[model samples]
Target: MIETKQTMMNLPGPKAKAIVERDQRVLAPCAGRVYPLVIDHAQGCEVWDVDGNRFLDLAAGIAVLAAGHSHPRLVAAMQAQVTRFTHFAGTDFYSESMVQVAEALVASMPATHEWQIFLTNSGTEAVELCLKLARHATGRQNIIGFFGAFHGRSYGSLSVTASKPLQREGYFPLLPGTTHSFYPTCHRCPINLSYPDCQIACIDLIERVLFQTTTPARDVAAIIVEPIQGEGGYIVPPPGAMQRLRDICDRHGILLILDEVQSGIGRTGKMWAFEHEQIVPDIVASAKGLGGGMPIGAVLARAELTRPWRPGAHGSTYSGNGMACAAALATLDLVQESLMANAAQMGPRLMDGLHALQHRYPQIGFVRGRGLMIGVELIEPETGAPARALANAVMQAAFQRGLLILTCGVSSIRFCPPLIITAAEIDEALHLFEQSLQACL
Candidate 1:
């Protein structure tokens, strides 16, 4: 195993502290920083702070660096594209890079359906476009979303995002005709029932409750969801949950939109998490790792659904820019060639390690996830209640111990390392994570 040695005993070392202080004075206060990690540079799964402190990066810029930081292939692609051209307003003009990227995205979709693509600059934009298309295509106003899902922060996306109150606190009176229902969180069943035995009642609630009382199924445009809830605790819905939703959408003629922003691009072993369920969605919103760090997003939909969108229906200046498309093509190439398989292989090793640690730590209430996108829920040892404070403390402790991690949901720490992470890196991260847990206790 590659040993991680920390050169600095104290965190926020001199240079990092100065830069952070400068940032606070000029930068906006809306950004919620979990810890004071001022990255100077990074490669693979390793990072260096401004103060020369070395750390293992498990967060991967919130799981954006699929091929790891500054991969030669991505850098070269971007550099070459910059020399030829950067942006020519993709909405109005055509570019080979843009066409190629769109083709690549369509190719990644299930073979059962032919897909069309609309590019954007971020996941929020992709979701926003999906919302508009769903309503336009179906001529319906009402939409359905699940609780504990973090789609994005834009108006339409935020309206369906029920993950955190802070995200929707003051942005109320959001997009009209949107409602939320329970997500099948088996760990803490929202309906106070068990999985497999519960028969996935949460999904049925949409038809039985929401459709009957508030929004009629005929008036609903789409049902947006994450294959694996990202910010909402990496909660993986049990088997048949997805198929049930598919059935409901098909019966009601409502579109099924999968927000693969954080769960796509091979983060979950499969190219797209929805593929695991063997049901093709009407639309898929992809970003995060799509560009390997460059800003890019795409709304992929069945060709029939998008055929109604006329010219000037929607557009963005930077969407499908040559530079972003080039970077994305490189990222897709890297993922298909090797990084994707690496995620599948390393995920088991990391999961096994965390499960073993759970045996030693009573605070670990649950461990769940697919491939490299995993979560470890920390709870109160005596009462078995969610320990939010302990979760935050452990995250901070991990950072101080030269391991970069972040917490999501109420009491879970998420591990979304780069897809290029190796066996030694996984073992080292597990070691640092155990030490962080010990220190927190």
Candidate 2:
């Protein structure tokens, strides 16, 4: 857990150029990509590439590092857990850290009734697990997802993910009975009509599909959604939409599942992004920030909802890995220490800059989100067509200028900085963003 200090120049010669060797000579191209200067180590909110170029990590490893890289508390927790046991004696035997984390997780959420949690290894796993829970609990088959959503890459989760066609291009015959409904993005309406004029047609579309189409609402096991769609341009569906879905789920005996995988744990300046509406979903899935960059995922459900899944109904080898639990526990404490407050203060500053950018450049279609989770829709100003080229170019330029960013949705530049980011950091990052936007333009 010690901070690493390997750099480019000092890299061993031909004998062993370990720092740059990962991508230069070895590894699969499809494993994803990074900048030319390979990173050797990082601390707090900074990452030093092999070339010794330090960059502010606005993307935070795609919103994974909640407490910042190699946090002291998290490192200590990992060290302590490693000493006790690097790997658990057996997956069945419960770890002390796991129990404590489970308790803390369930209690942290807002709900008048009892709840329970099941830990896993990744966000996709939690999401897939929730889907299974829906079917198992309701004894039904159908599952409804929304448009412009990015669930995960797994077979089940990806089946419902509708962000990019390439994600499903080669993989044919995805999970069946999974339907996609349009969500009222409000800013870039799919129906081409303005807000009040159209009255949130996206949500209405879901209702229409249920009533007029063959997909019977009663047969639907669950209605799954991200309180604020993360990968699909960090889109936050208009207010009252979520509450309406909750009511729909109740009326049809369908489970309401909220995937907070990326928007949970204060990323939205709230315990959970759905908290903005003060509504409690039947089940919630979370990961990413939950473990403070350590690998961990979980699904929380009302205590009664977990009843159908009896003993041995479901589980995983690393359901509650000791080290992951320790890291998650330490993360919870660290987030409370100061990261949450930072997110609350800095979220608005970043948003203000982004909104201003939209005003300056009509190409910046719409800006929307909660807390640090923000997204800027890139569009052809006149026609409102998605401008993926601009978004991608912006990300590339941002990386070149010692800042990192990501793109999503049809054509949206997204931002999800570590919760520990400071006001000064926000100002500097925004300055870089302005430069990146210029490059994109």
Candidate 3:
């Protein structure tokens, strides 16, 4: 049985309030705070604020802690590595940990092709690496991205990110030779087309329209896409959409880059979300859960694709820190052994409960996801328009009820708990979320 704790006192109790007050003065205003609660410590699937209020963590540090906070195995590995040596700058120096991690990551790839790995310090950097390799390998300039995607905040990745206009506000001129197309969606079709009948007109638009008009296919280096739209609501593409994209890329001789930064690493009950489609990408960017909370990212590509870039082409001072690699190795071991299976088993249970909630409350217009990466879209019901304000209210209410959830897309709440979460914990979280929804309604 799982023990659950819901805060009884007013939130931000003294100590948390003081810290938030200090933070407001010191931190950048751009750093958005979902709630006023200040984290004191976290373990497994629960976190406690400075005021000793315990809350169930459904966000998992924005889907980073796949092994859960401070797992004994991960802590031991990181501790052991730290004692031996902390930093040796794998860019110039030799480190066994880096090689081991690279091997482990490559082993997780689909068995269809021979692959290699380049490690980075964050998801954004991994994306930047993919952008550089794609452009270099093809010697082409133009790259295509979907309408609703969040690659990263870096200049190169930002060019492909179109999740929200706020992220791009005043940030131009973005990288040249970048264009956008609508991602295939069944829930909210961008082009007002239905599935099967529409026959993924979005993909056809890429070839027939985008290629013919603004950007020529000959100059296109790659098409960067997220297997499942992350920040643009957890929108999953219709069946065969990926395979169709692969065929188009093949025909055009354009590289396909899968940015699995948020949807990868067992979050979707698979090592990589792209496995669901059984398609092989020319380059893949991964981060969020790769290091199990430690800062690490990686770009995996075929040997021929990356071979063109010689040494000293791109390197970071903290590309492959010894401790981060140790953490990553431990994370991979746990994911392969049990966490991925756990996600597969618990995902259906969580979704069923959410679906039930949808029946009870029509405000939950839609619920869709794979594994722990679920999204519940809120709508006004009468007009069938996005209830963005209501979504924010529900998220805040959930926090007040000792449940930590985040909002995404236009008016959707994302439930991305750690993969280690059990059935009992899922039930508890569902109960709390239901209560919060009721209160907000």
The reply for model 1, stretches above 4 Å from the true place, is 6-8
lDDT comparison, 1 vs 3, better candidate: 1
Task: Report the Cα RMSD per candidate.
Answer: 1.1, 4.2, 1.2
Instruction: In candidate 3, list every pair of residues with a backbone clash.
Output: none
Against the true structure, candidate 1 reaches a TM-score of: 0.99
Over 202-250, each residue of candidate 3 has an lDDT whose tens digit, in order, gives: 8899999998899999999999999999999999888899999999999
Arranged by TM-score, best first = 1, 3, 2
lDDT (CA) per prediction: 0.93, 0.82, 0.92
Candidate 1: minimum summed lDDT over ten consecutive residues — where? 1-10
- The C-alpha stretches of model 3 lying farther than 4 A from their native spots are 1-8
Q: How far out, in Å, is residue 337 in model 1?
A: 0.8
Alpha-carbon shift of residue 59 in model 3 (angstroms): 0.1
Better of 2 and 3 by lDDT: 3
* Candidate 3 residue 333 C-alpha distance from true site, Å: 0.4
**What is the overall TM-score of model 2 with all chains considered together?**
0.92
